[model samples]
Target: MAIVTPLKTAAEQTLVQQFAEAKGELPGGPAVRKLREDAFAGFEAKGLPHRRLESWRYTDLRSLLREARPLADGAKETEAVTARLASLSLTGLRLVLIDGVFAPELSALDAIPEGVTVHSLADALVQPRDDLGRILSGPSVGADDAGLALNTALMRDGVFVEIAEGTELSQPIVIIALASAESERAVFSRSVVLAGKGAKGTVVEVSEAAGSAAQQVNGAIVFETGDESEIQHVRLLTRQQAASVEVQSLLVTVGASAKFDSFALVCNAGTVRQQHFVRFAGEHSEIGLRGVNLINKAQHSDVTLIVDHAVPHGTSRELYKTIAGGEATGVFQGKVVVRPHAQKTDGGMKSNALLLNEGATMFNKPELEIFADDVVCGHGATVAQIDGDQLFYLMARGLPRVQAEALVLQAFAGEAAEFIADEAVRELVMGEVEGWLHAREAAAEVSTV
Candidate 1:
């Protein structure tokens, strides 16, 4: 007798079918094509991770994605997208991707900066350089996740950037991905950045889903810092609540004596999940990971970070803060692992959240796994609301209840934002924080009225 297994969910079935049919027309050579097959198989077997999985207990993917949206058309652009580009303050090279497609018309790179090389992912795939062929064809760029796999299978056009050895960029490089005027469409985008040995630079990724129809966007970033180099990365999410779902991921490898600082701010999107994977590949590497989540409404936001210490004499620091209002839900899960041979490792992780209403929910989980005898690793999490005494003090000083609460919120969130070394970036984040606070206050007034 032959038995048949039940079919996967509609969304899962659609992803598999789309990849199978569009595999050839996607990109890359045989190696990448095969990798796509393996990735699809892995996702097929697992379907979508749910509460059953330890890694995804708080946020369930299978239930959130009921049906798969069609792939986004990368070749088109809308006037709204062009209009929105005028608001960004550009002090560096700008690369804009409209609706998952690279838009050179909107980008500002009049002259190629010295000591830097740039190529679109599509261009690199067509005529792979002897040095970049193997990397471009590598399987999934070592990011292990279903969303990343989906991005790998559908990654056709993105930016591939490299900084020459010992070159310090005069200005930061900004890559903006805008999903403008797209509804029920799936956006797949990926990028790779290489900071050459002893190089110094800043790379900022801004994801904009604002002022557009509801869309599904999945993005992945792979960054490598060479020995004795320094790299700064900032991920700012400014999507609107209309977006059905979003998955943003970061994969970083720090080399010996290199320094890496990564900061993220999440203040938008209805359902957004952030996954960050950091690996210390050599000794004497230093890293700092920090983020803040400002969420409201009935939306959901999740931030999961993993930092692995695989070598001796490495150090990592992580701090995350979340503020939830209305009936929104926020989640923070962070893990640090020190291998057996990774002695002299120093790692610390801390996450704190604040709930503004009774219906608001915040899930916090911090874990430390250590196999080395000579290591200092610890993790802690705290979830709380506004301190009554603090509120009373502000209220006694003639501040309204709303203003007092907002002040307390700013103090709580500013702790994480202060970790950003760049003054400009810090100010930018603070501005966004104020904007969100005002929006929350306005919403509260409307509800009461």
Candidate 2:
């Protein structure tokens, strides 16, 4: 008999080496170390996710990531961060994380209003907390995924927000995550947002590259809502590094009679995979998930989501829009699952993509798994180019071809953008959309010239 050992990729080997070297320095207690070891073992067994996995059919990390960069060290107040801070439009309460580490100097920690508590994960890990383990181990959805397992293993520092019961916030809590280009590194950050019973508020997560240097960012956010709570979450990925590789995950558990809404905007990136795993843990809950993706050049962007209806009387709505140009590739994969005992589940999902050039490609996979006969679930997907008639109508009005195309694209993306719960947030997202369009227009002019 011949014995053969499977060879590991450079990235996988580098990850293993990093974990072995940094496990002691990571946060958490004895239990957390054990958790980290277990997670790393899982990742070692499976290696990087590839096209062989059903969930990662479109985005192959093994092939895309040939080598892993060094892990990010602690961040300091630098010129890049200062410039980013100067350019940002201040709104609401802001928390800053530079290179995956919480920055107190850059964050408005003192301005946090009453009834809201903020704790840095690095600081919190030094103390003992009962629910810390549960927060670290996300919900059942995608818990076993290799990428998420890696996140759990080498997770560094993030923000933990807790809303007091029955507290209603007047403004949204903003979490700004910046990747500085001082050096090429890989960053792993995990954050949690807990909404107590009857609490109401909004959270906005903004991710941006402070400079042009490409960085690898593996980030996750967990949202747990108590019964009858209302929480709105918006994730914005704007001005990302052109050669960056970003894998962002969202895990949510909605309680009984709770209202949860989440929206994402992906305007620019090199390679990004934004995935959501949402479970309705209690009955009579409702959720809305929406996103818009704008990609050009050779960039690749993927949005994958799974909504699990594990209880009765759960409602979910998901809509996503993608605009692909140049030779970019876009993917949207949304699945809604109605368990056997989850009767009275109402779920609807739609994915629409627009290709701007002949070489551009879009992949849409909308699915529904209905184990309960009494549930109402439906899904639809469409991939098409811009309508010639609409373009002609705009061109007939003396609009340039590029401008007419931009109008059509904006209107197509607006349908999904309107679902953002907050008006100010919606307008902010649309402004990013317009910025994307303007960049496209400039590129068009350059190409023509």
Backbone clash tally (model 1): 0
- State every prediction's TM-score relative to the real structure: 0.94, 0.98
Model 2: per-residue Cα lDDT over 89-194, one tens digit each: 7488899999999988889988999999999877776667788777777678778789999988988999989999999988899999998856788999998898
Clash counts for all predictions: 0, 0
Give the range where candidate 2 is weakest over 10 consecutive residues by summed lDDT. 121-130
Q: Give the C-alpha miss distance for residue 43 in model 1, angstroms.
A: 1.5
- lDDT comparing candidate 1 with the true structure: 0.81
Clashes, model 2: 0
lDDT values for all models: 0.81, 0.90
Best candidate per TM-score, number? 2
Per-residue lDDT of 1-449 in model 1, one digit per residue for the tens? 89766579999889888877777787776666666677677677777777887778887888988888888767566766767677877568898887677777777768558988887776666663555533533322244566666776777678888898999977788898888755667888778888889999888888886345777778887788889999999888885645468888788888999999999888866888998888897899999999889988788889888888888999999999999977889998888888899999999899999998899999988888899999988888999989999999999999878888889999999998897776777788888998888887777678788
